[model samples]
Target chain A: MTTPRRRSQQDLSVHKRQVENLQRRLLLKEMLSLGALGMLAGCDLQDGDAVDKVLWTMSRWNDRVQAKLFSRTRLAPTYEASRITRPFPFNAFYPEYDAPDIDGAAFRLQLSGKIDDKRAWTLADLRALPQSGQITRHICIEGWSAIGEWRGVAFRTFLERIGADMTARYVGFKCADKYYSSLDMETAMHPQTLLALDFGADPLPAEYGFPLKLRVPTKLGFKNPKHIAEIFVTNDYPGGYWEDQGYNWFSGV
Target chain B: MPVHPLPIRVFHWLNAFAMTCMATSGWAIYNASPLFGFTFPAWATLGGWLGGAVAWHFAAMWLLAGNGLFYLAYGLASGHFRRRFLPLSPSGIMTDLLAALKFRLPHEAGTYNAVQRLLYILVLLLGVLAVASGLAIWKPVQLWWLSAAFGDFATARYVHFLAMAGIVGFVAVHLILVVLVPRSLLPMLTGRHSSSHEVSS
Candidate 1:
């Protein structure tokens, strides 16, 4: 058999491809090495997205794409009467100055925002509407938690009475102590939400947002803004006191 | 004259430095919360700021891993790895291992012997485990697959914490060994392992 004098075109093409493949692999390795060093040197800085923002973005996208199997009722488990222990760690606006005592004449709920009808309603008016009560856990971001039964007019009913504008996206709770909180429209209208007035069958203590406080079951303790000064319904994402301080406004438990 | 290749020496000590930083910061983070039976006291403060702790730990991790990768790759490509690790036969390895345990070494013993080989391998392997487990705990969702390897999220956190304990133990022993053999420590620092003839041997 005669020895091959020269490589065929096909053989040359195959050899060329192999060389290209090897070159690509080598290039990739070099890039990875450079990338690792780049991280070490703290290069490749970009702006406009913090780590928490990234997490929230991811969470929102995840929620939209993959609906989590959250319990629909949104009710917290109630403990036995005997189990109710000393001083359930109270939170939010307390001890209203305007109305030290239960003065129905003085207490008036003011509501204003994106609405054709913007006005105040009395506690009698709220009580006249359909009411709801549920035992729910008050989860604090500081890592402590408590469970309490809240009784009041359903937020959905209140929203209807106030003629909440269809375009409104957030409900900003203007509180007594200059403390403000905002809730997303979806959470604001959630079935378990309430404009709470009673704690465990007793009238809410002045320290625990007497007369009226927003009871949003799914939120952390901070989001339930107390001693409601006024309720401002807005069509924009309203940044709250906590949100300005780098805490997420939507403190969903 | 060669001074143990600049990157290799730098990477070596840099790894040791980063390892110590991680251990110290990790101790602080662990003491911040009590989970499982690993209860550290409330007073022990290795890092005063949680944010700083997180930043430094992540920064050190990147540096340690990068240096380790480069060193390993360079050594293997340059045939230094084979010279350092691969050539010894099992019989020679066993003999050297026994000699090391007994604090004995014959003439012409290599820079690293059999027991050193095992310990070196373990150190690298444990470093890798530390990084993997750390990532699993740090970003459970980001590196969910890694976390899944050690079971659920909490379990992975526990494992990562335990792995840091392992690293601390290794470092303690490593320091003791260096103190016992000042000659070995000198080479590591000065990048020169003088011949036995130069010593009192």
Candidate 2:
């Protein structure tokens, strides 16, 4: 009797949260669609010949193709420290000055969906996890690429520790910068995928996602989300910020 | 005699359409962070922006690759490449090149001259290089050896760009030749040789 009551209560809150999220997103899309950036990324709006729909369908189809092409044994090349790009470029949807500043002591990584633990983790807890470092290139969707060093917990290990449903279809991230992204299960489980906590020899600078950043060297730069505040594992498709636009969903590089 | 056979004409037109889509969108993508000092003009590009360009580029990639592969298989299996493009010697090419410079080289229907054969072979090789280099840039991690073969990631981009440039040059010369010999377009369009075509090897 108690268990049924508890489930009903949870369901009600979840439904309410969904409605609120929808309203927020509606407002955001409307505001964004008013600008020149909208013209560049205007798939959500009506288009001549429904060109946007065709492109989006093709992008989704490419996602499946890339998934088939991905091999578990394939590893993104690692460079020597000397080859690491000097003055590594900083990239974000917003300008550099607008990068969020959060208090480290108050930070907590919220976890939900398919996670057995369902408990938030602090910076200290994250630091205590087994860690590794890598020097790898970050290939952007545009055209340029950069190499950098990052040290953090392997994402598979982190997911295992959190008791994530390993078979889940997607691992989604909600970033403090209002940026969000999702990954296919295979990519999420890649050995090199990291919940990066440090950049170079320093703790991650706020500008580079001080608390956490998803470092996926095998994917395009936008796939590696920064300033992560929440993580969820789900079977549902979690569309990304750029992905909801015209960019391909599986932007593997 | 058929100058351009039905299957060959089909493949040719399909390749032309696919190449146009890929090249125009690729130019738009190149504009985002151009490897060179300049970018393609807005009018020359297909997509309105980087994201749009990328979507078109990847989508058209399938058409180009599929049509090109079919074309290659058919060309080899039918012995078309052997019959039309064989006996290509450097001296023959030089002879044709010098004659062509004086505007006296013959355009024999149903036969490829040494210079024309050399250009076709070079362009075919460029097509393969462009696709391979494109895959390298698209998936440098999974296709690591491919990019490495070209020297690196950046080198792959360079190779892709050069291959595209070569194909564009070929297209320009091809169009000019068709304009000069207006009768040439008929064979491609109708897949038949109306003139008393020279079918000799």
Candidate 3:
């Protein structure tokens, strides 16, 4: 009995020492991470410059990983009509009052780059195309979500109709509101993606990307460029408004 | 008295650092497109801009998840969960709460009182909820089942926000208690405490 008690005391002491050693190691690691954070803090670099380059590099790496994992066939879930957020909020770089006023009769979607057809498209021409609609959630990067009904031509159909180079790596959009964005060919061809011309049952309202919007349900809200003016397919990267401002270029869901 | 085991101490600090980064960066991200009407000031948040905040948030998210997993595995494998957090009686917890409300510290040195155990368990559960809801929001389409479980994307965001609020509350209480009894931090820092020290029961 005495020998067993002595052995237990020795084992406890050994265990306590091991715990102390681990705690010390952890403390050291904690200090090291703190140092790294302090360095990051000290840099205090502006967006799109210096230290931000590292972050952008990391963002690009993340984009590659996401793109690699992206499945073309997988669709964003559609919601029921009852689930649609009433008064679907108008969100933009500008205020709702500042929504662009584009004339439907005069509005034309310009086409360019790596396409057989270079002719501009009038609103009527787009309306003549087969129409499709979906009620889907718009997930914002800022941590809020809203469901909205978007009605438009399937972007894949439009892309095919225009004789775009299906082999191209990117499909870039220039919006009338100066908010340009681009998508990977895979995302652009996603079945759920649309060239939205209407909101709910009405012709697309001025406050909701009048004339046309890219309704990309598989992406975060900012990636869905509104009030599209021009679309071009290219192998070269076409930077976007927010992407240039340091948001991730591939803001996929 | 037994001190915190090595794995527990390591995971604890790692989680603390990750959670701090997550909360601060999350605030910055939230300010970009606020859920409520108001926004957090730029100075108050860790990241200066929406993009910067997102970078920080993602980086810390990985750390939080990894550390949390390590903690969970260690707790379960070492029987720490059963010994320290379970077998909690409501009567004992109520007594500890009353004592706490009366400004009497109910804990003895190197041992948790019922109230501390319950709060710790609650915070642990909240952390799990935060991570789950975060995943639902982060990958709603890929993790469609999780999103559906939370009702929808908007509901998941709400739950995530609520979990964050709960964690913040726990942190505030924890910090206050640490200030009130600075010695409580020693075992966490050094993995040892004077066994002889005790509070009157």
Question: Using lDDT as the measure, which candidate wins?
Answer: 2
In order, candidate lDDTs are: 0.62, 0.86, 0.83
User: What TM-score, computed on C-alpha atoms, does each candidate reach?
Assistant: 0.49, 0.88, 0.82
lDDT of 1 by residue, A155-196 (tens): 877887778875677888877667788887777777788899
Q: What are the per-residue Cα lDDT tens digits for candidate 2 across B1-201?
A: 589889998998788777877898899889988999999988677667788888888887998999999999999999999998998999999999998888878888778889999999999999999999999999899889999999888889999999999999999999778656655666776766644423222
- Model 2 chain B weakest 10-residue run by lDDT: B192-201
Could you tell me which 10 consecutive residues in candidate 2 chain A have the lowest summed lDDT?
A36-45
Better of 1 and 2 by DockQ: 2
Q: In model 1, where do residues sit more than 4 Å from their true spots? A: A1-85, A92-104, B1-201
Which parts of model 3 are misplaced by more than 4 Å? A1-54, A96-98, B32-42, B102-110
- lDDT tens per residue, model 2, A1-253: 8999999889867875664465455445434643433244343213644767777778789999999999876899999999999889888888889999988899999999999998999999999999899999998888899999999999999999999999999999999999999999999999999999999988899888888999999899999999999999999999899887768888987
Which candidate, 1 or 3, has the higher DockQ?
3
- Measured with C-alpha atoms, the lDDT of residue B119 in candidate 1 is 67
Model 2 Cα RMSD, Å?
Answer: 20.1
Cα shift from native, residue B193, model 3 (Å): 2.2
DockQ of 3: 0.22
Q: Residues B1-201, candidate 3, lDDT per residue (tens digit)?
A: 447777777898888888987887788887766778887766557667677778777767878998999888888998988888777999999988888888786556656888889999999999999999988888788778898899878788888888999999999999777656554566776677733444433
Provide the lowest-lDDT 10-residue window in model 3 chain B: B192-201
lDDT of 1 at B75: 82
